[model samples]
Target: MKNALSRGLLLSTAIVGSLSLYSLTTKVAVVTADADNAGLKLPAGFGALVVAETGARARHLAVTPQGNIYVKLNRPNKEGKGILVLHEGPTGKATITGGFGSYGGTGVYANAGYLYATSDEEVFRYKLNSKGEVTNPTQPEKIVTGLINRHQHESKSITLDKEGNIYVNIGAYSNSCQVKDRQKGSLGMPNCPILDSAGGIWQFRADKLNQTYGTGTRYATGLRNVVGLDWNSQTNQLYVMQHGRDQLHDIFPELYDTKQSAELPAECLYALKKGDNAGWPYMYYDNTQHKRMMAPEYGGDGKKVSPGNYIEPAAAYPAHTAPNALLFYTGTMFPEKYRNGAFIAFHGSWNRAPEPQKGYYVVFQPFKDGKPSGDWEVFADNFAGSSEKVATGRADHKPCGLAQGADGSLYVSDDKKGTIYRIVYNKK
Candidate 1:
């Protein structure tokens, strides 16, 4: 009888020892980083690693608390998969384990035990099991449908507020709401017909099924395009980064020189309220002038002040930078200054011809009392790979999406080469 008891005790001890070894191995792998910081230039004490090479047009991504990463591709792969699932292994790098969702779009969000994703004209949700694995990837419930997709600015970017509401951006098809749409010397369409269905944000129930435009409420208007948005828990408000219109000098050479065109209308960050209008077709925020100037197509030249009724931007950045993702930090891993502040990923600029194209990096905007406090600073750079590449407007990787890990690490996605980078601060 004594020998039997001794044998059982030894078996239990062996099992416990094996588990300890496994746990230690996983901890070491999770904290490790690539030696070169994955060719990214981050702030002091911050390092980066290549999470995975998804090999698709990874537009946006969501990281589960369990470390599972879901990346949304801009288009479906040859296998008809638009979502790639990455699971980090004992090697400190993530491996593409699975993929699902046969359609493509630009947005992906994980909240309330569900994975919400968007196509060009629809939003869908899939239930995630306790392990953060999507249980019904092959059959997702449609939350929204019949959205406008003009093939230009057609990506439907989405975000969810805590109150079970989702907001989707429907971009205006017209460059400046001109009657002829990007044609030089064309006047702006009177009252802008696109405003009735596009060029705005619509709010709908996050959990609802098959909700269309008739069921949703137009939450905001006059936004030319918005690809990045997040719900600010610090202020209980929705914040969005707007991509300002293009072709200032090309269409209106008499009013704007190439230098002015390169730097005229600033990409804007807006804190939204219901019915807020940011004045797209009529006006644009000028960071240099610190004022909203009436759009040339509408009636006034570049110098004319805009109407006071138009909602002003909370902050503005260099024009044509193409702000693609907005994330408000709420983690303690970074310094106290980063808490509740915002990170914006600029996907580089193409409209700054004759001058060097700029802004293929991430910027940190400080926040005080739930509003922007001081000047924004570059947080991560060199995604373009070289200064010559930035000068020639040829970026190797454009930062398009931002996500925060369970450990407060920041993740940025590049659609060009389908690379995912994870940024961590002050690692041991």
Candidate 2:
């Protein structure tokens, strides 16, 4: 009786409101993951399965309301295609249905009857039909172009809000805006010219076309780089994860040891406002001290505190974790504990040498009343395949992108292997 009731619920309503018990049998439901869970360590009652494997460098992803998957490749495939569309099959695997666009970087998003994507230097959008298929697969309107991409930390991740505005990340070209970037004993350039065109987030009209880099409003400044950002509808605000600058010890040996360099500046989660300044190049958030500290490139010892009243991070995580994706959980599939919280996919680190490189997994941060509620905890792990691999900085799969399906399942993409893993909550 328990098995029968669980397998078939009538869910009666206005004839079209909910599914009849028999109607669900024909649906393309996601099957349960294997006993091994495809090599992921998720929380209890959660399971994950391999969805699809694109042979390109899948960076970020978007899923349409109808469950179609759009994956952005970091580089164009041999066929010069950048966006790969996949359709879920009956047995829970995904099939590549089609692809579009010719250039690539990061930032693929589906919203408001269009599919938006980005290259390192431009943003494009394609019209979509009611069925969620791209009407113009090859001919996308160039929304914004000529963005500053100096090839250092230059992936243009993007997100959109309800107000018809699109936000883009233009990463800094220099590690610390130094006169001789990353060189020992180098001083920061006056005023950090990089902040003018790069090192910040910009807001632009989502519907406009052919807009150049100068046309967009500089939404916020002083961020070195942000790969994962999301517009939190629950809070009606924008949030971003900034990648802290690197090589502190190599540049200022007297001020920092290698272990300190690897773990000094914290990867920050910033709840942003229109004119917010996060104080990059000039300062970094030291998680251990939980205070903003002056950067060594700007002539400060490690202990000097920043004087400016810049915005402090909403939350902080370990440095060099390389947070690559941020998603505010608004879906209903997970338990109430996850509602309105944030899930960040850390791509892991290469610079945490002598300290055991870490962070090839996903983490969950609780939220309450539009602010972070408590400490973050590791929600998923073992993408490195073993403890030995993470200790040696050899992660087999680096989770890069995240998307939520119509059914509220979470999809994570791996850039290293281009594997997409779909995580679902199922308990017997």
Candidate 3:
């Protein structure tokens, strides 16, 4: 009887040992695969690799110090989980290690040993272990909840500052905050009620758990919808890319022609402070005019200028580009030209139909003294698969999020193809 018991214990130990051995072997075999860079075009010194064919609608991503990549999906995977954790093998290849979190979201950021993510209606966080992986997948602390999600521009993008504060973007549901939203010639609301709880960035405590909307402070207001935002540590300021109001011609064809509608309102990048207002619903910045113009909903004829003392954008880009992600590069892997600059991922535009669709690439804006110094130029291109595909709005991949790894490599996430591309500068 004693021998039988000993034999059973020995068999159990062997099973455990074999499982561990298999895990170790698998990790070792995860070498970096050669990513096809044929489709992506870049500058002379930079190259990209398709690290992982994630097969999930990847939105935003966070890279840990230990080199683990955490991706937030716009929708849940087969197991109903929205977060995917990836580990890089010795050969620089990344493989999915685990999946967690139930509700899909558009924001994922890591700071102070915690991985912060947001669903459309709430913000949640998971504690990270020494290896940069989540310690508890099934349980996460709900940092903020009860956010309004009205389906139109409902993505809750997030950013974290060095001072332990988290900023969340609660996009306005209506395009122009019109009286009868989106209706032709609909008058603008004098005082947009959505500004009370939405259409702004809310600041919350990074360490606090289970807080609600009332607990957060409206950091900045009058932003129509901001999907691309980041904290520039160098300037110690918050920066955001505001998606300008759409349908200028459709709403007021008398004031604006189709060509003007496709190109009048410029996508803007604003460097924000605590009480800053970008002047939405009331005014829209026209890069061509070089001034903030009053919207047609506000009784403007496309040539009327705004009277409000609104702040101007740090830099402005072409209209309908749909800038989706912003990152201020602080890494040393790239040349001096790229360091301290801002990288913007344009998710491409659908409204520029009569005209050719544009902005399916990543752009670099040079900065000096914490402000834009030179013209913003395309850093990476050809994500639309081809110029013909771009013109017809049939893009193969759209760059949605940008992240920097510990080794100074840049990572871009595509929601359309569920792919992650890593850009590295091999000039040296």
Candidate 4:
């Protein structure tokens, strides 16, 4: 019995030590020099490569089964209104196939034998040929139009499930539901008047084109900004990453410090269903308590929980990581453990002061039996050079979109540098 107890203690110590070592290596690291952008030097069996560099402020991406890549850019005037297509030829190089842009925003996806792209006010579809190239590019059928465009949080992220149901993210224009707008201590709408229009996810039919603003039903509500959204095939559900509201310290100095501000309100990842309400203006994710917390403007301290009202996120991240893209990994290139995990592109933080900034990298959160089982790890990094002090205020690239190629490779887009990277595991 004594030997058994000793054996147990020794095993426990070994397991803890192993986990500590992995955490130290995988946790977010600070980078400051331009050399860091040469692409991360991974473990012996893995590698990363930069596939495309068009300087187009690329935001999101969709890759067809035949290995062609489609990138969506945020610059309206330069990139125009259609989607940018890049072809990977036999030489393993990437070249622009074509540029199509009638309108511009940050939403783009490939679904149901068509390329569905969304701008500030509308969604359009283009037919594709067998080669994964856009055919009949001259014609774009408007799937949805006439959405709100108030110049704040105007991007409408689009996604589709297996059931042919389409979903669009309509972010709230108001910051913190302010009555006077961006003012501290101001009251939100008594009944959240914005619910009638924005602050929700609306559902539409994928086959229905040119549907007006009121054509769809409100599928979910209370999301401030959800630029990153995707459908999880294994779960048959839609997942969204909300870009948490900023300036917590600036808004409530009495309750928050600069460091806390950088790390307080958790950026949230939610699984949505019809009629789901994720409290946005009235509540925010508290990273410390790991729960939905009431907003200060809604009459509560930082400690007060917003119960029975807001849907809790499946997972929470540090404040201001600015998760701009979400993708479920269904690839076999990496270890078997990553088969059902999720990858998030955090564009990094801007308001977290008095310290080195974090994020601007890719993180992989593993799942087991549909539940998060391990700590999130940095799958890719060194995007903004290699110095903490330098990267705090300046960055060469901020990750905005994530996509997995049909060949099981990964694609990442950077809005800051307007670059696209294709990361594949090199069997060495």
Candidate 5:
């Protein structure tokens, strides 16, 4: 009888010992960078590292509390996987541990014990374990499905507020809601039928299961396309960067010159509330004039002003900058000046031809008390490799996504090069 009891005690001891070893092996290391940030250019005392060169086209990413990084790919990998889970090693390198989600997508976020991601037509979420890894990677719950994915501007970038609501950008398929889209002589459609289902931000319950388009509410309207958006916890409101309508001079040469087209309508940043409309198709904010001008399709020349009631943009940028990701910094690792400021990833422009393509960098917009306190400045540059590449619109890496790590480091994803860069600040 004594031998039997001794055998059971030894077995339990062996099992516990095995678990301890396993935990040590699985423990993730905190990532840090060298004094000089690899190759990326930044301000003094800031550094970055090309932590992972993910071969997949990384779109948007989310970092968990445990430093686990999940990236949503714009295209499936060679193995037909669309999402990648990365584990950081003690040496500050990250390795792709698992890849799943067959459908390719652009939006990925982690919140409320779930990792929320989006395909062009649906929004899905995976339950996260205590270690911040996906508990069920193979099968995620479809939170929202059957969205309008018409192939043009269909990427559904998403963000969740502190409340239970999740916002998704449903970009308009048509550039200007024209009667004959993109045609030179096309007129703007009256009442703009696309606004009924698209061209806006939609809000849905984050924790709800299997919601359809009918189950969501249109939070804001008249946005042509919004790839960059975030919920600012400081302001307790939603902010979005709208991709202004394109082909201003191509289709309306008589109204606008090539130089004017390249820089006329401003890419706008808007702080939004429910039921807010920024007036697309009818009017566009002119950064030069600092006023909302009537669009050519709406029967207006370049000099004509619109009488339509449209909310003014909180800030405006050069046309076709293509802000793809918006992040409000709330971390203490950076200096106090960075708090509540916004970092925007400009994916670069292709439409500003014959002048010079611009915006292959990230910019910082200062904010105080939820409003723009000062001018925006280029935070990171040289993503295009050289000035010639910027002029010709040839970019080595176009920044697509922005994420904040638990350690207050910034992560930027480049879809063109499938690279992930981690930016950190060290006081001099």
Candidate 6:
């Protein structure tokens, strides 16, 4: 009947390589709450909850050093994976302690004690312990893997740098490279040899987990997409945001105007180093003359500009609110004006079509001594449940990943509902 140690643990591949079924047995504290939901709102000492809701498409999050909370879900409807842990208490309650996915696009991180994860091509690591859990999640290793998923900007998103290196964005499956991507003459990719292998951001060597995209190193390039990235230990550099690039009226319909393609390019933010370039297709970033223009496929069209190069943007927004995630608040809960500031998450915008849909939530910006000092707030709103409906940039909840905890609180992720908020600063 199938049970002799489950058929010798499935024909014994050395008992499945000596079994380590992604260890997970956490539950030291429990406290569920969901009297309907619709919560969150901070400052005034701060607080917001709902640590784990449906639990299936939660996106990014990493915390550990014994505060537990790993998240990274997004398999949805066909589900089967791991990494969801949780486990936090000291009164703020949270506990799931079971989940460890890897093998395809979700992005979870944990650093130092090692946990790392990813999958729209590959990256993995596991062997955490000393309370952060996962002592050997089914033995993952593969640090990199063929990463080139042509599914609309693909999802890689990774971070780490303090000398350990390991940045990974790789987006650009065609859009401004057009030539058929957005259709028209479908002509584009002029000098875009796919930027030496997909748009930008590569760097590797976080202990070399299993590297393979030809090994790594191409630290920066014309980036037409970067679902937000981080590493700003007070200016150690390497920040990113860029998502700009969309059909501005189906590629220069005689020079924009669908209401100026909802607002015209701009939606950048950069800091990169080590060979930086930051100009895609040709150049964009012109939030009312902030500068760097010329990008109607390389020819001066929307008011000229761009000549001899690019690289400029420490700020600029309003376009397709799609900035996925970026963090940099050294924690301590909040106030001190939010320490190193820089939240960001915005999974909102359906082209701003004629004027309506705009970024669904999260936004902070306030870096002080390392740059960007103030201007830009709205840290978490109703996540598009309805702020007067324009619907179809869609979102019953769409904030898309950002994490930090180990007392510094704040962990939001919502690949369209599968929630996992947690804000906190309770100071009661």
Using all chains and alpha carbons, the TM-scores for the candidates as numbered come to 0.93, 0.94, 0.91, 0.87, 0.92, 0.37
- The lDDT for every candidate, in the order shown, is 0.87, 0.87, 0.85, 0.75, 0.86, 0.73
| lDDT digits (tens) for residues 1-428 of candidate 4 | 00011112222434322222122322221111123234663444455556678777788888876557888777653546446888865323478877887666888888758888888888888887766777866688888888887878888888888987788889888778778777755666777787778888888888887787678888999988888888888888888999888777777778777777778788888988788999878888887777788787787577888765678788888777789998888866556777878989998887676656778888888887666667888888777766562356587888899988654567888988777776655441
lDDT of 6 by residue, 78-142 (tens): 44554677776643456775765644466777877787777777778787876668877777777
Global lDDT of model 5: 0.86
Q: Lowest-lDDT window of 10 residues in candidate 1?
A: 1-10
Q: Candidate 5: TM-score?
A: 0.92
lDDT of 2 by residue, 230-316 (tens): 999988999999999888898999999998998979999999999999998999999999999999988779999988869989999
lDDT of 5 by residue, 127-161 (tens): 99878889888888999998898988899999999
Instruction: Report the Cα lDDT for candidate 1.
Output: 0.87
Per-residue lDDT of model 1, residues 153-244, tens digit only: 89899999999999999998889999898888898988989999999899999999999999999999999999999999989999999999
> Which pairs, if any, clash in model 3?
32-93
Q: Report how far off residue 234 is in candidate 4 (Å).
A: 0.9
Off by over 4 Å in 5: 1-36
Q: Count backbone clashes in candidate 6.
A: 13
> Regarding TM-score, does 2 or 6 come out ahead?
2
TM-score for predicted model 3 compared with the true structure? 0.91
Candidate scoring better on lDDT of 4 and 6: 4
Number of clashing residue pairs, candidate 1: 0
Greater TM-score among 1 and 4 belongs to: 1
Measured with C-alpha atoms, the lDDT of residue 386 in candidate 3 is: 92
